[model samples]
Target: ILAALSFFATGSTQTNLGDNFVLGLSQAMTSRSIKEVTDSMTEHLASRHIRFPNTANEINRIKEGFFLKHRIRGVVGCIDCTHVPILAPAEADEDHPPIVYYNRKGYYSLNVQLVNLLVNMKILAANSQSPSSVHDSAIWAASIIRTNVERTFRKGNNIWLMGALLHICRNAQPGTPEARYTLRHSQTRNVIEKCNGLLKMRFRCLSKQLLYHPIRVGKIIYAAVVLHNLAIDFNLNDLNDEEPLIIDNDENVPNIHNNHDVLNEGSRVRANFIRRYF
Candidate 1:
């Protein structure tokens, strides 16, 4: 609702919808929890004769998924780092120091690099909390994709390269056993990148310093994502195609029983969101 209002309320570029929405949302939050505030805002927008998505669930799916085509399952949105300045941390703790960051924080202002994935553009898998120094490859390596699989297998601590099916396959030579296996496993993961681009374009607040507290900055991000859903739900834009790059079939990928039915704790697969997350 804030996004919708911001875009329509002003003709001037001084107040970006992404930034203003966050400001308004943070103010609204002064009287309510995030969820409560959002519910109230939905009602308020309706009363003001402006329409917004009726629910957060709908907002996440229809608005962001269809409108923006942010196709990472359980991801709400994706964003890479844009630079920032920050006051240095007051401690010598190595974990908190600015190593890879630019010398602005004396220390450094860390940008949270993430792709907020959505499963069927509904359920949000929160962004991974990692340091700014972490690159995309590193982030993907540390992702729940690997961790969850390891946990399921009751594996140990080391990151096994052979287990990185996608990477191993991409590096393999043609017609060889392991090469054939690696080539088969490699997946084209680009939809999420496109989502990142759209997000930066739509939410300018994320591209620059918010000049607000870190908490407020976070609100700014959330508000933009919420508003993104609103625009998509309203048909301001259309969904993009999200298909993984499929190399030659290796026949080594996990095979599960087709005879039995499985669900995500919900008792259904396709019904989980009615759309496949690429």
Candidate 2:
């Protein structure tokens, strides 16, 4: 079963599994069987491996690490979205325009958000099933992790999430506290970019366009993340040895108007951080 999963998670097909050496031992296993085995393994291991920090100590460790290493006070994790390309699903209406899966990049994809621990590259949580058309800030606003962070972390134990800005204000003077803070935050939070790169590079399936059902493709993503976490936890250097891939953010993209209250709160929090720490 492990072999079956590794083969598929490595971006190889079930047909390749059947044609390769392992299953050919007694009799060539059918592609259907190979798929079944891998699917089962992915689900079981994902349940066991992927997890969020539950206790206060665990959460504190993450916060402390971010503050000490990244120099980002109040940050527990860095959040960002990446597109996983996929073929448009069948059984769709041909007459209507494709709006659900079509992203701004002119392709069908799933916008997967990953939240990784800054101290360690371990993936603490992820939301991988969102349609590609959704905006990154939209995904963050809807995340369950956002609610949990609010509920658990109190006023004194403030935990802020870091993400790239879609647009920067032209009025802010260069080398000002606000501008400097933004620059430092972007540089420190870039570890998530490395985390995403290592995951895709290690599991070639993520780097290639997936030719599977969107639902199943989500599972593959989760499974790949689980494997990436395990590799990091186990001190495996092979996956991390590769240089980080250059990920492009939506620079110069105009910000969408959102709830006034939410925007005010975010601005206030950032202002407090700059005043207190930056």
Candidate 3:
């Protein structure tokens, strides 16, 4: 199973896998069967390996890591979205049209959201269920991680995931606190780009167009994420020297237009952060 999974992650076709393995295996295994295996592996591995910090100690460790590495405090993770190219869905029906999978990039894809612990480049949350047509902000608003973060905040926990803040420092003087904060924030948030790039480089399947059902493609993505974390655990270094892709932020600034309270709170937080750190 591991061998098959390794081959899958490395972007081997089913025919190639069959040629390498036994005939009985060939007769039993189809693309759908492989997807089934991948799904099972993803679920099992994610349950065991991918987890958000729930305890104070675990949360503090993550915060400490961010502070030590990026000179930024209270950042538990970095969040961003990456598009995984896929073939247009053949199974599209009236309710789920094929055009829905077409992204702004001129291709069919899944807009996958990832929240990674910048300190270790380990993914804390991954959401591959949204189609390419979905906006990143909508995906974020609908994410379970966002819900959990809100709940945690209500309970008096004040941690946050780092996102792009370049807009805030726009046109500001170079030596100003806003400019300095933006510089650090960009440096810190860049880890997610590296993580996404390393993940695709490590798992060749992600870098290429996945020729599978849209649902199966999502499962494969999850499996790749699990394997990526496992590779990090094992200290594997099979990635190439290619530059990691920088994921473009659909919306860099937080949306505070709808709620004055949110705008005020964010302003207060930024002011406090700049005053104390920048």
In order, what lDDT does every prediction score? Answer: 0.37, 0.69, 0.75
Off by over 4 Å in 2: 6-9, 22-42, 93-98, 165-175, 240-255, 258-262
Q: Residues 1-278, candidate 3, lDDT per residue (tens digit)?
A: 74456555667676666666553356236454676778787867787777888888888899998899898877788888888888887653665567988987688888898888877788888888788888667788888888888888788877877764223555768889988988887776666677787777777788778877778888888888887788778888765557555444433233446877766776787777778778
- Sorted on TM-score, best first, the list reads 3, 2, 1
Which digits, one per residue and each the tens of the lDDT, describe model 2 over residues 161-219?
A: 77663222336678787787867776865576777766777777787778777777787
* Predicted model with the maximum lDDT: 3
Q: Report the Cα lDDT for candidate 2.
A: 0.69
Model 2 worst lDDT window (10 residues) = 246-255
Error of 1 at 3 (Å): 9.1
Q: Which lDDT value does model 3 have at 71?
A: 89
Better of 1 and 3 by lDDT: 3
Q: Estimated TM-score per prediction?
A: 0.39, 0.83, 0.84
User: How many times do residue backbones clash in model 1?
Assistant: 17
Lowest summed lDDT across 10 adjacent residues in model 1 is found at 157-166
RMSD of every prediction:
13.5, 3.7, 3.5
Candidate 2 lDDT score at position 17: 54
Better candidate by TM-score, 1 or 3: 3
